[model samples]
Target: MNIKKHAVITTVIFALNAPVWAGEASFIAELASTTLPQQAPVVASISTSNTYFMTSAPFSANSSAAITHQPQPDPAITLPQLIEKDWWGALAEITVVLVIGELLYKTGEESMKEDFDYEIEGNTGRYFVDRIVTTESWKLDDNEVGMNWGHAYAGALYHQAFRNYNFNYYESMLGNFLTSGIWEVFAEYKEVVSINDQIVTTFGGSVLGESFFQLSEMLDTKEGWVPATFAGVFNPSKTLRGWFSDDTANRFDRQQSTDQFDIYTGALYSTKDTADISTTTMLLGVKASIDSVQGQYDALSATPSLVELDMELGISAEGIEDWQLSSSLFLGGYTQEVKPTTGSRESWGHNWFIGPSMGIEYSSLGQEDEEDFFAAINVIGLSAGGEWQNADFNISVRGDIFGDFSMVKPFASKDYQASGGQFWGTKSVLWEGGYAYGLGHTAKLTLKQATENCY
Candidate 1:
């Protein structure tokens, strides 16, 4: 068994959300929920990045640099404030993007040049009807990466359109529902609606989309150019239209949210390669999270309460070679907090939450001869993890364990479809979208660490 050690000297500055949930921890059984956007948060910054934060602020830590917030009530944002926006403009923005993408896909690609060559013996209406009739649960034609991760990225685009106009979560999802539905129903009129695309796009946009949109909001509440750029990258629509351009001051809910985010960058040395190709590389990562844990929560509701997304990219001298994206949304549940007994040694804040949750995680690394090693999608399952925090040095260690029914492709084999030929310069877009598909019941384990100024 070859051993690999990852040593990272990271400047985790932007969104402090290390792979592990921050000080937001309560008890495992009573821990996660969200606070609505009541009072808008205030922005503060320090050196390197936006490091200066007020004490008791959710973004602060026990150490001078890292801190946690205490829950409190503030103002209420009326529905009218949320609904007041140019909805039509947002819709058009989304439509234009989808239309152009599909048009280019069908008209531009050589393989898709025969895009409308459907097997129909009738006119357009009949072809449309028959196309709908023949659509299955999923379209197998698209590569696994596109279905699993790419569609979701596309979905985030739809979710952000409405969010840019100041739309709330459910409303943004409404937009996602409508936009993705249209794409399935008419956007790519010639090709049959891709059921998998519809589901992945909609759901991924709902979870990932909202996460990034809120991430934009979170970053906006901070004072710095670096955080500002990230805010734009996550929600380009809002960025293009000029951020917070109106009276909508309630976008960043610092008053009610129990979220803390930070940018992560590091280095790793590892030798677990099945093909004996040990490697070392630098890392850069960011996180999108909101209300992951709090004082009170109700799991009985179907609305989404918590969204936690963590990503880590490995960069070798050759370029980015490995990465991981893990996201989870609390379907619903309640929170239980065991506050530090009046004046105890600050070690008594215990909280926990139990509720339904849905998530998607994809990790691609290592290589077995000519084929690559991959793990993608945990369709349905439960995961448990633990975290440790230190107050003096402002250090945190987080570990994640996953077990579930998954859709995975084990390796490069003649048995499945080819998935890695599309190229972008020296690398391949095929790497972005991995190889074939298969089913398996698998389990995985991952560990990560973060500190105030560790490199």
Candidate 2:
């Protein structure tokens, strides 16, 4: 009986102390509010309907006061958010990606380096055992043009020559794949050079240090070869490129349940000696991408002879590994050609690319030790959209249905646009391939020994 009575008393006391616990929590919250100014209350006034400084004012409020309130907060953001926001964060991500890509390219390079590693055999042009992995193998007739178009001749010992290398590391840098590492580096030196009237080109060059640093993230990842979102900078060198480029983006975003919106603008300016006058271009854009693939429009206009509006419908799945597909119907009216207009000249055209694409990636292969790789294919007319590879070789093919996309001014504008307008609708094709031996594999004999023994 005594034990039961004691238990009941303890239970009653515990229940009575529950209010004390609540009181302690209230005290701590009040203390925190008082200590942190940023955490102070935001008192909204009835008459002004504006939120004002609440710290210096008295803590008294009338029962009939119509003021509302909320707590203020500290200004700092989390690290992950900061990383997604700052350019430095982007640099770090790119660096890590580059290092990995470099390693993968080297892995492939080593497997095939020996095929061409040995010296020439008997001074014959043919390499009996070109350890150089053949990325591409094929035959071309007169219809096809070699990457470099030039003439080659030879003299006894002394000769003078000149040649162009179409596809090399330097040229590759101008493309979308910035983190291509050695491929980029190799391309840099892939030029046809002439000596003694004979022209020769080899893929033995290295990438520039600056180029490597800029495209770091694209280095090691499977999708690293995709073009970066950033566009190329326009300069005097590209005055003849036919495309007007400016460093800017039209940005628009908004919060829900409000008509208010935010708009941001950007620009770039430069001057060159050959260029007679300095020009300032203003890019103005306003837009919002809707969740549904119905319709979206972005337009920009400023200065004389500059006006553009693009309307597009974009569709994207929201989830891990979800792919995005978009089609834009473009209508452009160029008040003046990218080049300054002289005499009454007007050019206007509308072009559209209806490209649909899908991609998938597997993180784990059945074999535990095997590395993960992704494969995707896209078709732009005759151009095979994605890249293809096996253990021994890799191939990438690209071609425009018509040569309309060609950067060079092939023919006269009147003649070309009239005749070449078909070229845009016509098709051009590009194919590239690479073959390499498996890792740690090597040929035991030199080219001379291998050739002699075969006979």
Candidate 3:
């Protein structure tokens, strides 16, 4: 109906017609081989007909008899089998991302070096060795907010490559981390190993990649060309393969399961207060959650888990902005229900969960901004929560303990600083109890302290 759909259909048709073309060639060759035996008879019959039709006519018999043979049906050709999970394709995708990223970085560096009249060292081997082998202290790099965010997105591309090949979630996450590490260690030989970039690329990218994956899956399940096109755009790796390879024909009718995942897009505005300055930030975010309960619920099934992924892009009127991502796989213990003469018996349930959460954040974009353009990663950390819900009331409490390893260039400092320490304890509680119209109140407290020279 539309250009995109038409394009997709055309590509599929072309792929399927490849075998048809080959078969047609074979059929023509077979007809030529069989024509030799019948050639004499055909010629004799044509001569007899000509003689019988023109008995007394003086006809110049220079005309040749044309043989009209009906085309034979083409035989079927066995198309090349499509591998469901192509490891080589995944590796090729990773290579492309790394190569292109490095090339872009080198180009930008060269342009800047020429403009600033600074000579950049060309000894890539030495640079790599110095950064990889030497025990150098962590120092903040000069990369700005855009660069850090781009690195994270690059990592997401790597994740998507593996995901496009049907890799599992954990495998895709591992690919993201490994690809980022490879880029940091080898691809950008001119730059030092960036601690912040690694954190942002690996963890933040995982959040972004997983969120995009879910959203794309959701879009793909919709029954419209617009949604399908958006789905392809959301997952560029899949789009590329679909357009360029026969994989599209193989997966044309593939369906995605939508019962286990929920995707939502929304906007929020919030204000943060620190000392004497208050900053209001507006964000556009997408959140996706996968509930394991959708498949099957077994009493002995090792603690049911829920995976949540969130990605946000925020900006302030004062020109401060950043990209933030977070993902957590929460594993819950046994569920218990209490039917205490409730108005709605179906709403009573109690659940407790505890799991590790990891994420990365990069902030501060303006050139003249006093804030630091830093990356912070919270590694696998513990988060525990309990919720009790009923028809008329709901109560929940949550606590998180995590640590952040950060590379930051403070506003007042001339150089970058590296810091890492435990976040100690953070807690929150929510209480809401109403039958017809629900009203709720929340309270939170956080205590965190970090020390310098943490490697």
Candidate 4:
């Protein structure tokens, strides 16, 4: 390995220096031939033919001192020949580099192996490591039929993976001609038994697109605006493995943990990965928040304040048959009435909502070795998402037209609320459009791989 590394380094150095060395040598040679002759020559022999001509010049001194004094061609110092004489310098430099690189590589490799081996052999004290591990998988979909906005999206899996305990954080994004969307961001945790592959506990949350969009619009300006979203989920996959009763199936359902509403704290425990399909999972957690809203109009202004708390019990099947589907029904309440300002048309009230969602994704097996294709769709409450993937590139489209959608907000003085009831009369307009100017509107890029593994 050390030798290979040295060779690679040497090759890189040579590649970088070849053109420079050649150009320098040529320049030096030209300067030597043209400039050196004008100056004193360090070394040159005058043949008898040139010497005789110099001595017979007209009006030349006839004294013995002048006749015997020989002017050797100014010592010839040609730069072109100097490079050849110094070629050994470059060789010596490369040799020294190779030697040092070999030593470092050997030392690093030994250190890495020794450390890993020592840890695995239980030399360290018995202590749990709460490290977040990540794995990557991708899918592609091409030539999808019937979809108006066909695009591709990539998904990432990050979580705390260990025996009897684990957690997850997921995100996705895709765009096409019609629209673009993101999965926002969410995290989930689980605990289960190792023997039966049973999930005993879980907790998670996700940010909703509508909420994200709305918040983004409130803080936008002339340029543009983003969205706002925050959501969470809870489930336990291992607790219902033993029974076929209705209680087991309902164990994973989303239900309020207590009468409290809108709380974001809770105690959670879970088991390890025991089976391929993580079906039996349970979650019990609290969700809560506080908010202040103010309104400004031409002649009226007022601010409103509110606070809320909620607790929920939920169960779900995280992974099933190359697919995952989950549902939850939660109930909660908010501050009944808090009037921060008198003359504002706002009220604080308690409301409960149950949201159910399902997602499905498909990709050809072993297709990654060569090329791959993939597609997926998901929906929860008033939001929806879909994607397509192919070998060369991926495109995706996501749009949510339900609930309170967020709008673009530029600077504080200039904002467009999605909830703004604006109308353009006498004509209809498309929400999105596209056109290609050259070669069907294509873009090409080149990627260079790192020579050293940094990760």
Candidate 5:
């Protein structure tokens, strides 16, 4: 093995070496309310509502109140899972990703400036062997575009396409694996297949993709020009295809019932040294939490128990200086509800939650070149929290600590002055770029309080 020795360790870094300033932690205070779903709570599920605050960017000060429902069990109520499929949409989208994507990519100047002669020597079978199981192996790609949100976004599109075709979550994921393999082997035949891309594209895409898919479904239930525009933006290809479905163009037939939906907006005024901005940033956010998760526990279906998204876009004189978005999907976990006792009746009630979660965070706070490592995919993590609800007011708290993975700029790179992603990405992608794949961690602390006069 012509293995070389270098000071930089390509393995995971389990230290707090992040560039975020500790003092830059933004204060969070919001006044919010949760509107319960119209339909009764499903069996095996409890009625729940909450609003949480976090010590993150886009700080605000407001009060909140949530009308919550207590837990109840129904032994007789049992529902069967529904399964659907649309093979044509999924198959066609895959074709677009490969055939059309390749065509468009070739038009770019950077993509045309390529080298490394690759061809099918000997026979086609031997070529397949060398590419898949032999010489043409996998390597960590060093490109900034494909390594971060780009490939994951592509994967998200694939996941939504499969889901829109009525494929369950696991089925969509299975399709994702197949789609990625096909793209790596068939689409980009010139370069060696990326082993990291295989994993990141499949799993990271699924986490990010499933979150967007569920949120898109939630938005589809709304009625307004704003909701429709946001929905179409979030799921563009799916929306366009839905309109042209069978050439019918029926826009209202895709509505799906959701358990809860809450939307809030705030304006954050930043001082100096706190953030990259000095002006006020308008903030808007939406959150959804569903209890009765449809389908079976086999996890082969496309329904997540709890899906919530928090996104903030900072618009100032610089025209959107900071943009941050985070999405979380709670797959599964065990909960032991400890009802309030005589001694702990005031604050501690039969209200608590703990579970494993999958999520993705895309943050471009300052400039792309200044802080590019903020976006990290939470491969897998744990989330646990509880609430204190009374007739007059409510207070809920949640804290999350997650291990993250991302394509971080190398601590030291040979090409320090490369401008734009193309400079370090083009010509060479495996090890010649300013960034490389690595692992990190993030911790969030949330607390929300409210006072309401409700009967």
Candidate 6:
């Protein structure tokens, strides 16, 4: 059966079986209450009369207390009361992703095997069963490097579509996995299932998807056209839904919140020295953060939601250039307050995050070479950081840790090397602090090491 039919049957079975399990406790409670002694009716009548007498009295100091003492009925048990059953939105999102994948495949965006032996026909059921039960060995395909990266981006878009329909973070993640799985198993039935595509699309997509979601949320709060336009681009599912249905727009309206937004642009200079050669590169960057503004009593209590973006363009003395981008979105955090005998109060907070981070480095010395070695790393993973802030001075110190699945490629002279396999590692560190006048600076150190052999 197709995914839709499977989902419908599963939901029906659950609906039929749910009442039996949920009604057991309720039935026993009602049975015990029904079997009480015959004098219970007389006692209940007397209690009700007393309650009525108290409530019917003229206004008095004790009158309010009488209402407080009244008995309330036990709440009824129902299917919705026992479980949250909002899977239709999720199912619709999955269907949309599947349909889009089929469209892309049919439009020549993807290639199929020459024999076309896996075509859906009288053997549709057997084909699905075979795909599910069979496991293929890991191997590399001939798709371009850009196509590989596009898979992660597609995954992120799929995730955003699910979120647009009000799915939670974990549910949205499963939607991405399902979308990728559908594309791998059935959309390209003639091609071999790719292990790399699965990992990058699901995990890396999560990092990018969450960041995009936060950015879209942040943009939605602004009243200007520029922000709204970008928000729609980042979250197309919501934009499209709004065009077709008013209820979808209303639902998203309820999700928007009042949050602070700030944007800053600056320049950075870094000097590198190796042996007798020294090189300097100039970077122009823009940084934006939402809901990260500090308050007077922020040291005591602060808003924990934050979405941050930093994008930079690096130019060497010789004019060779590269682009770098890093983004992070935090769902929630834990905070603690510290008080010292002679110093101001300090607040420390730690937050968990998922997002995309990418960096590129040039190999050759600058100022003369037309071509340089290109090394780039892309990863998506769980990240965490702790910050100590003193709202009195508006200063804070932070340290971050990253554990991720990474793809590293080294290229030169208009040719790029293919990524062999997925690698796992801790990639970078950032330490930053700022003063009242924004006179402070940030310092970051990155470490890259190979942990496993690849193709």
Error of 1 at 118 (Å): 0.9
**Model 1, 254-309: lDDT tens per residue?**
55466667788888898754545678889888776777344122212212456678
- Model 2: per-residue lDDT, tens digit, 1-455? 02243442342243234324323432333343344443212111111112111111111212222222322321111111111123343344435434654575457665534323234456332332221222121111111122211110001000100001111112221211222222222321221111100111111001111112112212212132222221121011112122455622212111100121112344424344542433333333322121101011110000001111111221212112211111111111111101111121231111111121111111211111121221111111121122222222333332223111011112232344446443432322111111000111111111111211132
Residue 167 displacement in candidate 3 (angstroms): 3.4
Location of the lowest summed lDDT over 10 successive residues in candidate 5: 25-34
**lDDT-based ranking:** 5, 1, 3, 6, 4, 2
Q: Write the number of the candidate with greater lDDT, choosing between 5 and 6.
A: 5
The lDDT per prediction is: 0.51, 0.20, 0.46, 0.21, 0.53, 0.43
Better of 1 and 6 by TM-score: 1
- Candidate 5 residue-wise lDDT at 452: 50
TM-score to native of every candidate shown: 0.66, 0.19, 0.53, 0.15, 0.67, 0.54
- Error of model 1, residue 402, in angstroms: 8.1
Q: Which window of ten consecutive residues has the lowest lDDT sum in model 6?
A: 429-438
Q: For candidate 5, what is the TM-score?
A: 0.67
CA deviation > 4 Å runs, candidate 2: 1-85, 111-183, 186-455
| Runs in model 5 lying further than 4 Å from the true structure | 1-81, 86-89, 109-117, 134-136, 146-148, 244-302, 336-349, 410-433, 453-455
Candidate 3's C-alpha runs over 4 A off are 1-85, 111-140, 222-234, 242-287, 293-343, 362-375, 391-394, 407-455
Better of 4 and 6 by lDDT: 6
lDDT string, candidate 6, 238-315, tens digits: 677768876522222212222444444444554444324444566665565553311111100101234566656667
| Model 1 regions more than 4 Å off | 1-80, 83-90, 114-121, 133-138, 144-148, 165-171, 295-303, 367-407, 412-434, 439-455
